[model samples]
Target: MHKQSVFSFISQLIWVYILLFSAVSFSQKLTSGFKHTNALINETSPYLLQHAHNLVNWQPWSEAAFEQAKSQNKLVIVSIGYSSCHWCHVMEEETFSQEDVAQVMNENFINIKVDREERPDVDQVYMTAVQLIQGRVGWPLNVIVLPNGKPLYGGTYQTKTDWIKLLNSLSKTYKEQPEKTTEFANRIAAGIQEKNEFGTEKGSVFFSKELLNTNITTLKENWDLTYGGLKGQQKFMLPANINFLLDYVILSNDAQAKKYIKLSLNNMALRGVYDHVEGGFFRYSVDTKWQLPHFEKMLYDNAQLLSVYANAYKVFKNPLYKERIEETYQFLNTIFKSKKR
Candidate 1:
């Protein structure tokens, strides 16, 4: 009984020390020696609040921010990411927190921090712009918008060195060749508008097994026999379509489809992108081997992934798929779920 009491007392002391250290660390992070005034301090979104103490002059997305951009004749730098985004946090630490980077941002651009979850309308607009420009889209989506709120240029994550150079180059271009910038923004804005245009849609089409077979053939042709994902350099999660294919193939008992699904899932599961240290998957692998990830953990991506893994488990009875589903949700509950939920 005496020994039990001593162990309990030690555990209690350890817990107390942990609590105190956590509080002090959090307090110091919020009220650090370095400070700057920015509009994100007044925002309620957790993503915005994360940047409240950033040395960069980060204003929340609002009419006021655009108005300030218009008045100052400055380009608006829209940095779009959600609160749980890993690379977003990385950029915050390596770039936004740096004095030199912040100085460039504060002087040249009216920087706006957007929580994609909070302002999905704005995110949709800019993501389309990014797609139109670069032919692809992903977060840490950085878009340089004109003073009139036109997205002139957009891309995903960048290193601090490349980011600084891009900032300098874009700023100089904006100053020297204003017309070219306006023309590009005009084209992008038009493309964004055209994105929703499905002019004169076909009323109906007859479904056929032949059509399905042809589609599966296309997938099989491009399917990487060795690496498992689509035959490409990139490794987008591509869950919805892949999941649908898996279900259809299983229903039809197509051996080729089954082979493709198993290979893709196995490759993705046995990779670095699955976050072996944690319980979730990252945005995508940069290589065909699924080794390097962009490291953003969006809820939508995880949800889609969960559905895919759950279906795979249901069909194949694979223990790996079951574990992936369980661990993914564990990640969501532990890191992504807010107190409000």
Candidate 2:
């Protein structure tokens, strides 16, 4: 539960994740022998380039691709993720590269592979829709959209069987029940537009002390008191949640909330979610205990987490929080230095 001690304890387990990361890169390289290639071959993005050899005819997000979809009267498959995404790599290997899977996708849909880092605009639109439809979202985000680009269905990381079934079913539905598909797409479009719209209502919203307390109380109800982080099978280290709670604790001197935040921070830092070897956090844990990491080190997540840890160091002055901030700083600097070359 301390500085170097946590690293020493978890060092052995860290190598297993390191090996998995290495193997994904290695397998991606081996695809050179596969005869199929797509327009993604010409893309500069490392994430898009990774899918260049897939049998699926992947286009970088463009007017031309959408134009083709309009011309062909086909739905669009907008699959978005970045290079460091583990599920994206898994979906590429297990679903995209397959001959049969690619056949269906190529025949039925205009498949657009988006590097989320490069196209946060596109990601935001469909990501909001996915959250609206599924009430949850994560990468390797796969959405089926109308040719004009309204989403019909959105989900993440489908197995090859499920991917095929989904494409076939959606394709069939679009062809047979055109009115129904359009109506559904219209609803999703409305929800996305409404969610993205800034509330322009004139009057300033009043926040009473009682109302603020009620809001905090409602939030606390969702907290996983035992292991920390939100109550769910999966645990994401959402810096915003911690950032808000940290500020509230400082202002209100809320002992109970402070204790819970400390517990959350401690568990997050010491658990498998934080890379013991690499000095950055993974995207999330597959389990609530923060022991089963999803194995993708997202820069945005790590950068925001750095702010959370540093601010916590200001308040708690915990040496462990300071250590995490230092480690994450070093990790980010190393990444930047490499990119500079």
Candidate 3:
């Protein structure tokens, strides 16, 4: 009886020690040194607040940030993203949180973080710049701009090593080749501000079935014959492309186009791009076979896909298309209901 009592006493003492140690460790973490917050600390945006404690000295999208960049004569890095972007979170954790990366960015650039959801005007200008410069755009959109906010260079997510190297290279070039850099920035600014000239020439525009069929035939050359979408390693189920083809097939009664549409739809539904368990489609597939998804469920993509499948079922009467339509409707309804809750 005495030995049992002694064992219980010792167990209680060990538990007390563990609790005390945990408390001390937590307290030390809280008070060891004051963790610095950036200019995003006071922002009401959820996406901006996500980076409040980042070591990169991130500033909210403000005129003050631009003024500071002008005063310092440093290139401004405007990085844009939303709260739910997977790549944005990845860059935050892998690239922005690092001490060395923060050191270079803080010293050389006036870094600005923008929640694309909050300030779509800012997002639109830089997105246009990135698309014009790189021929494509995606988040987290990182654009290096002059003090006046004209984009110089832009890209999506970069690894820590590539990011640091690019920053150093750009800073060096900007410092040593200021004239050339300004000229390039001016050219990009012109491109962004350039108006669309297509179909603006003074001429009588003519539309004919032959021209439409010819264009469709040319577009088919880009389609993947084997796996069924556009010939690319990464496939985005762009519903616009699919819907246009569907319209053509319906009006023209083109047998080959109908076959291609069925092939593409079947592969998309069967592949990993469509979540068999979850009843929604992924944003895109990383592989040509559509066997691997990027795993970001975008509501817009799924909604468009639902419409495409519904229209497809009306024409093809494929039971799979009908099933997918019902499933996707349920998925969207569930999401909306949850948001209300």
Q: What is the C-alpha lDDT of each candidate?
A: 0.87, 0.91, 0.90
Backbone clash pairs for candidate 2 read none
What is the lDDT, from 0 to 100, of the residue 314 in candidate 1? 81
For candidate 1, write residues 1-341 as lDDT tens digits: 69999999999999999999998887667667656756776788998988988889898888988999888888999999988778788898898889999999999999999999999999999999999999988778999999899999999989899999999999999999999999989999999888867454677767798998888778778888887777788888789878888779777988877877888888788788888878888888889888888776668789999999988888889999998898899989988789887
Give the RMSD in angstroms, all C-alphas superposed, for model 2: 14.8
Q: Over the stretch 50-129, how does candidate 3's per-residue lDDT look in tens digits?
A: 88788999998889999999999999999999999999999999999999999999999999999998999999999999
Q: Pick the candidate with the highest lDDT.
A: 2
TM-score of 1: 0.76
- The estimated TM-scores of all candidates read 0.76, 0.86, 0.85
Error of 1 at 21 (Å): 27
Q: Candidate 2: misplaced stretches above 4 Å?
A: 1-32, 339-341
Off by over 4 Å in 1: 1-32, 199-202, 205-221, 232-234, 247-254, 270-287, 290-298, 313-341
